[model samples]
Target: MKILVTGANGYLGQGIVEELSQKSNVEVIATGRKVDRINVDVKKIPVDLFEVKDPYNYFGRPDVLLHLAWRDGFIHNSPAHIDDLPKHYSFLKK
Candidate 1:
């Protein structure tokens, strides 16, 4: 099964990817805004969820997508986070 995980570089995401990747039947496709910096042993795709046109174009067609990504300072609803809301909606529409 192909599994796509967004925010794959974050604290919880890293652990989730590690655990999921250990499954023999799972194919992990890890994505993050700074995926290049993520130190995971899996297929990594760097994507700014707020700027992508067609996510599938970059992420390929996966069997499932676990949306865990959030803009920086999301907890406090910073400017970037606020601006990302529309982008998030657009991505979801696609």
Candidate 2:
């Protein structure tokens, strides 16, 4: 099964990608704004998730999409979260 993970360079994302990479039946595609931090051996794609029109097709038509990408997640009141809401919604809508 093909699985595409967004924000794959984040703390949680890195751990998830590492675990998924060990699965023999799983094909992991790691994507993020910066993928250099991901230590796992997998197909890493550095992209702006908000700009993706068709995520499934854009990321090789993965069977599953793990949307972990977010900005200023640690800041409870970060304006970026609300600012990017539309982009996130639009990306998911497609």
Candidate 3:
């Protein structure tokens, strides 16, 4: 499965990128606000979720989208748990 990982340079995303890189079953497409990262085993794409047309803009359809972004008083660990604005979630559905 192809996975699009948002906030992939953060704590959870760091581990996710490394773990997925070692696996042959999934392709990890890593994106973050700042592109300052390096893990050659996986393909890295720099995307600032805040500035995009949508958070999922550059990314095409993915088998799974592991959202890891937040707004306002939101915290880490569960960006998906919070109710993101319609424009954001709608992007993923596309």
lDDT of each: 0.80, 0.90, 0.68
Q: Deviation in angstroms for 49 in model 1?
A: 2.1
Tell me the tens digit of each residue's lDDT in model 1 across 26-74: 8999998777545657899886776777777667777888888876734
Query: Distance (Å) between predicted and true CA of 93, model 3?
Result: 4.8
Model 2 Cα displacement at 16 (Å)? 0.4
TM-score of each: 0.80, 0.94, 0.66
lDDT of 2 by residue, 1-93 (tens): 999998899988999999999999999999989999988789999999877777878999898888888898778899998998888888777
Query: Which residue pairs collide in model 3, if any?
Result: none
Best-matching candidate per lDDT = 2
Worst 10 residues of 1 by lDDT: 71-80
Between prediction 1 and prediction 3, the one with superior lDDT is 1
Residue pairs whose backbone atoms clash in candidate 1: none
Instruction: Kindly provide the TM-score of model 1 when superposed on the true structure, using C-alpha atoms.
Output: 0.80
Question: Whose TM-score is greatest here?
Answer: 2
User: What C-alpha lDDT, on a 0 to 100 scale, does residue 4 get in candidate 2?
Assistant: 92
Models, CA RMSD each: 2.1, 1.0, 4.3
